[model samples]
Target: MLGVKKIGWSVLLSLFVLVACSANEKEQSVSQNDGGLQVTFTTPKKVEAGKKTEYTVHVSRNGNPVADAEVIVHLEMADMDHGLNGFRGKMTESGVYKGQAVLPMGGDWIAYVKVKRGSEKVTKRFEFKAEGGMMSPEELEKSGLHENGSLKNPDF
Candidate 1:
């Protein structure tokens, strides 16, 4: 009976750890207008301190890619009271926009992504955490980016 109880506890602990790890791997997304417009995007999984990192955003409306819209992001550390860096995103191709900015330190950050289409626009916010330091070339390669902060493949 003692061994059976121990196995149950171990299984519970393992499940807890699996849940925590998978939470971090999930993509964060923000939606507005009851899914009328949205942004499905990817930023650098992590960033290095004082180093510039690229954020890739893909904008869509009614399940279709929005190509002519302008993308911008305003980022700030959520855990601290301080000014933040904000930049505009440029459309690369296929409704994908990319922007590069440097995060000052390692902490939790929030990004307000704005997508402007014609005379109308929508804003969605996403939060992500990162550590300090630049990523190595190999790490960048695995991240679907090149040394110049551009996606290595057009399909990326």
Candidate 2:
């Protein structure tokens, strides 16, 4: 009976660790709905730091694609104050907008996608991780790419 109980506890511990690790893994895509608008944001399974990566956002309303909306993606470090990085998304097709961002470092980051059509506007936030090498705050500042507060270059 003692041996059986030990084995059971070991299995439970292993399962708990597995679940915790999986929960921390970054999601490649996330979807959310506000009012009647639905937005789906997608990124690469693994985003590398200091590399330009493509981001995609799909906007729809009432199950129909929204092709006439302006879309923009803003990125910021989740744990630290990295200012605000903005990327203007260009519509590639109906309901699909694509943009690129170069993450400053490898860590937790949030992407906020803003969609606007006429007077209707909605914003969605997605959290993900960037892998690869890390950079110091000083280096990021010297890179001449980091902004202070608001978006310095929307075209970037």
Candidate 3:
């Protein structure tokens, strides 16, 4: 029937709209390296807590891609008052450095990007809110904190 077909199309359109809206909810942030190497980077639009999130860093100096540079990412949930061990990045064939970082919890976090070339280093920081699963006990234990949930290194 014509009415049935119209209803079917309406349902399909609603589903499409929901999918599109969901896709837009993921948060992404970009930062420019401030110290030296003249690099910029993008973290995933959305990253699940307790899972590995891909980090893509484009390194360049004077408009040319910098090669053989070491990229390190130090992630910390400043709101949660803890820091990750940091992730080491690898250079891709396209001259972009890639790294995977696992954020332990969902909250306010800061990403410190450090790019090292020989003895020179460049650094940048990005702040963003993460949306996803809660941190497990195992993950919290591994964080730099005592079993009582106190910071192991308070001086930091």
Candidate 4:
């Protein structure tokens, strides 16, 4: 009767609204590169302990960049007194994240990269070497200097 028609219209309208809202709520953060895949890291791979370092990640396929992707970074050092307790980063840009981590000491460390785009996820691990002896240019030259402040073995 009339009540049945009204109920059908109401149900259809509710479904439409739900679909529209869900479409707007989709959270996607992954970009496609060229034929291959690549992630970007803004921070330097070499850093001194206790110093802050930042990094970022991006997805690409076929040498083209893909936009809007979620990337996460994790750092771990085995020699430090703290074992994986201090590590965190934020995704500041699309398919990019900034990270601040302190190099525990001079040794080998493991850095992890995790990226997600829709249902696809990529994870990679990299090894980093940290050491002491932060020297100036003058000091470096001095260390490599000869007795006469010239080349030790001149070849001319």
> How does each model score on TM-score?
0.62, 0.73, 0.66, 0.49
Off by over 4 Å in 4: 1-37, 40-42, 78-81, 85-94, 133-156
Model 3, which residues run further than 4 Å from truth? 1-27, 33-36, 138-156
Error at 16, model 1, angstroms: 17
**Cα lDDT of model 1 by residue, 1-156, tens digit:** 125774465346445544554567644444444466678656664444356678888877777878878787877766543344656888889788898766554456788888888887787778766554333456556655455333444321
Candidate 4 residue-wise lDDT, 22-127, digit = tens: 4544322233233345765443634443444555555565555556656666666543332332233455654445665544333445666666668777766665
lDDT string for model 2 (1-156, tens) is: 125774465346445544553576664799999767899999886676667789999999888999989998888877666666758888999999998777765566788898999998888999876664444456555544553323345564
Write candidate 3's Cα lDDT for 79-140 as tens digits: 44443445677898544888765665455567788888899887888776555434556675
Number of the candidate with higher TM-score, 2 or 3: 2
Model 2 lDDT vs. the true structure?
A: 0.73
lDDT preference between candidates 3 and 4, better one: 3
Task: Write down the lDDT of every candidate, Cα atoms only.
Answer: 0.62, 0.73, 0.63, 0.47
Ranking of models by TM-score = 2, 3, 1, 4
